[model samples]
Each structure stands twice: as C-alpha cells, then as structure tokens.
Target: MRILLTNDDGFYARGLQTLWQVLAEDETFDVSTVAPENQKSATGHSITLNEPIFVTEQQKKGHKGFAVRGNPADCVKLALQGELIPRPDLVISGINNGPNLGTDVFYSGTVSAAMEGVLLGIPSIAVSLAGYNGDDYEDAARFVHHFLKQNNFIEGGLLNINIPPLPANEWKGVKFTKLGKAVYNNVFEHRLDPRGRSYFWQAGSLAPETDPETDLYALQQEYVSITPMHSDLTDYRKLKI
Candidate 1:
C-alpha cells in the first residue's frame, strides 16, 4: 500500500513520528510524510490561497519527510496536487496529540487533512490519541498499522478514529460510533497585552460525554472509536420539507 501520512501537530511531533516508524516497519507499505512545519492544531480545512507556501526537505530523528509552512489541509493539498510525492493509495492524517471526538471534527486540522484526501478521490483516516498530557502513542500507532493491514481501503471514504488513553491490554476493543455533541463552557478573558492593549483570550472546557453510541462515550469507556465521515454537510432528513 502506498500511504501518505500527515498531521496538524507538525512534522516533529512524537505522535506522527511514532506512527511513521511503525508503519515503515511493514514491508508491504510504502509510506511518505508531508506535514506542517509548525503546529496547526484546530485550523480546520483552510488552505493557503494568497501566500506562497514554503516547503523544506527535512530529516530528523531518523525520519525523512517534507515540512510545509502551512496548515494540515495545505500539506495534503500540495502533496496530492503538486509533485511533492507520488500519488498515494491511502492518506492517514494523524496519530494526533489530542482527541478529535464528537463535534471537534468540525474544527480539527487532523480530520481536515484526511478530508482533503477524500475530496481528492482517495481513502483516508484520521487517528487521534484521546489525551492532551499523554505522550505514549505506541499503542495507537500500532493499532493504526494493524487496522490498515486488516481492512481494504474504500475509495473516496473517510474515517475519524479516536483511541482511548490506555494501554493496549486495557482497551475495551473498537467500536463503530456516531458523532456526538461536544458542548463547551466558553469564556473570553479580557486582559492587557504588553503595550497595555486590551485583548480577549478565548477558552472553554468540554462537557462530559453521555450518549452511549457516540464517539465521546466510546473513548470514555476505554474503547477505540471509529466514526466514518464524509464531506457532505447536507441534512438529508430535512430535504423532504
């Protein structure tokens, strides 16, 4: 399989690196990476249209890849449309540092990169480890590799996967789930900048998961959540009206 890997956490992130190493170990897989030069978390599907996107060939920590000075979507776009890499059989965006569950997919750069692949007529997957402070991505990376080996890629399909922050043995297995509400208690803190200029810092805390069949709940129960996603935002139920 020819696989293209990307993430919103930059090319140097541990999650991406771990996944790259794991996937490269498989003799049947041909893996290439093109990722952001800097962290582009929660950037959504925005692409660089006006400015020139800079790309550098980089080799770090025994991994070789292209680092683009752009968002996650831009990396995938350039890789697919430009001559950065060969056309891939599959696109895998992440092994992200944090979870992209529920409605977080709408603003997740990790998911957006995968969505870009789907839009370009390739199968894609977005994988995230459901924790912010956790640094261990070995299990998640291994799971992703195993998943690829076990399943055949569907053309133009997209899947959003979230792994619970637990050891492999402790996992409750995988669950096919639906997107759930991700409510946040938002706040804007007013503060003064260095020049005494007023600024507002946006922040929020996510509400606890309650739905049993949702991605959030799957993660909460230590199960790997796999939710099939698509670019269509149409509310088909309302079409009859």
Candidate 2:
C-alpha cells in the first residue's frame, strides 16, 4: 500500500524520521513523507490561507519527501489536491513528541493533519510515543504497523494512537479508547526577555480527571492507546441535547 506520512513536529524531528525509517524498510508499505518545514505543534487544523503554500521535493534512498512551508494540514491538503502523489492509499501522521488526548486534540497539529486526510476521503492515523513519560518509540512503531496490516483501511478516519513511556515488557498491551479529559493545570506563564519584552506561554500539566476507559487512563496504566478521530465538527452530543 502507498502511505503518505506527515507530522507537526517538522520534517526533521527525530520521531518523524525514525518512523519513516521503520516503515520504509517494510516492503508491505510504500512510504512517502511530506511535512512542515518547521515545527507546527499545537496548531490544530490550521491551513495556509491568503498565501501560497510552497512544496520542495527531496528524494532519499529512492523515497519521496516533501518539505512544505505551511502547517501539517496544509501539507496534506496541498499534496492531495495538487496531485503530488497521484492518490495516496493511506495517511499516517506523527510519532509526535507528545501525547494528544481528549481536549488536547483541539490544539494538536498531529491530530489535525490526520483529520485533513480523513476529510479528503483517505484513511488516516495519528501516533504519539511517550514524550511525557519514558518509553520505546521503536516498539510503538511496530504495534502501529501491525494494526495497519491487520485492518483493511475500509473505514476512512483518523485514529489517534498514544504509546506509554514504559519499556515494552512492562507495557500492558493495547487498548481501544475514547478521548479522556485533560486540561491545563495552570493558567500559563509569562516571562520577560533580556530586551524587557513580556511573553505569555501555555505551561501546565494534565488535569486531574480519570476515566477508566479513556485514552488518558490507558496511558496511565502503561498500555498503548488508540482512539479514532474525525474532522466533522458537528457535535453529535449537542444535537441530542
């Protein structure tokens, strides 16, 4: 299968490249990498608008890689619409340096990139290894690969996968989960630079609500967490209410 990979951590992120190497070695997947030229973390689904999106091609080890001057969503959108790769069979985003769970998805560029794929009628998945805790990213990549092998990508949507930071032996295996509640612990932090300029930053830890069947709990219990996501903004819950 032809797979299109993108990420929010920029084209040169350690996790992004490592994932590319693992997937590229497998004959089962024809991997293509296209990503933002720089980090676009926490950008959500924002795309380049009112401006042109730039794409520069790089061929490596007989593989195609594109560095785009835009957000993760923009890269995917442009690639699909611009006929960059004919038609990609699947879209995989991340191996992101951090977790994307519950409310955090609202601001996650990794999840957003995958959402863009789903919107374009392609099957997609977003993955993150324990940047929060300590864990084996290589093992996480294997498990995600197995999932693709097992499931036919008949269902086109985004699957958010979060791997725990524990060693593989200590992990509790995989768990299909729902988004869990996680909010900022503190409002934020503002500091002044040497030039005497003030800046505000979003700095906080995970909030304190625990749902046993949620992605958050799965991570806490050292299990690989997988949650399907989507681009549809319609609140089904709100419609019911």
Indicate which candidate wins on TM-score: 1
- Cα deviation at 114, candidate 1, in Å, is 0.2
Per-residue C-alpha lDDT of model 1 across residues 81-149, encoded as one tens digit per residue: 996999999999999999998998999999999999999999999999998885699999999988988
TM-score for each prediction?
A: 0.97, 0.92
Off by over 4 Å in 1: none
Among residues 3 or more apart in sequence or in different chains, the pairs in candidate 1 whose N, CA or C atoms overlap within 3 Å are none
Among the numbered candidates, top lDDT falls to 1
Worst 10 residues of 2 by lDDT: 130-139
Candidate 2 pairs with clashing backbones: 134-165
State the lDDT at 163 in candidate 2.
86
On residues 113-172, what C-alpha lDDT tens digit does candidate 2 reach at each position? 998999999999999986754345787777777788789888687789998866677888
The 0-to-1 C-alpha lDDT of every candidate, in the order given, reads 0.94, 0.85
Question: How good is model 2 by TM-score?
Answer: 0.92
- How far is each candidate from the true structure, as Cα RMSD in Å? 1.1, 2.0
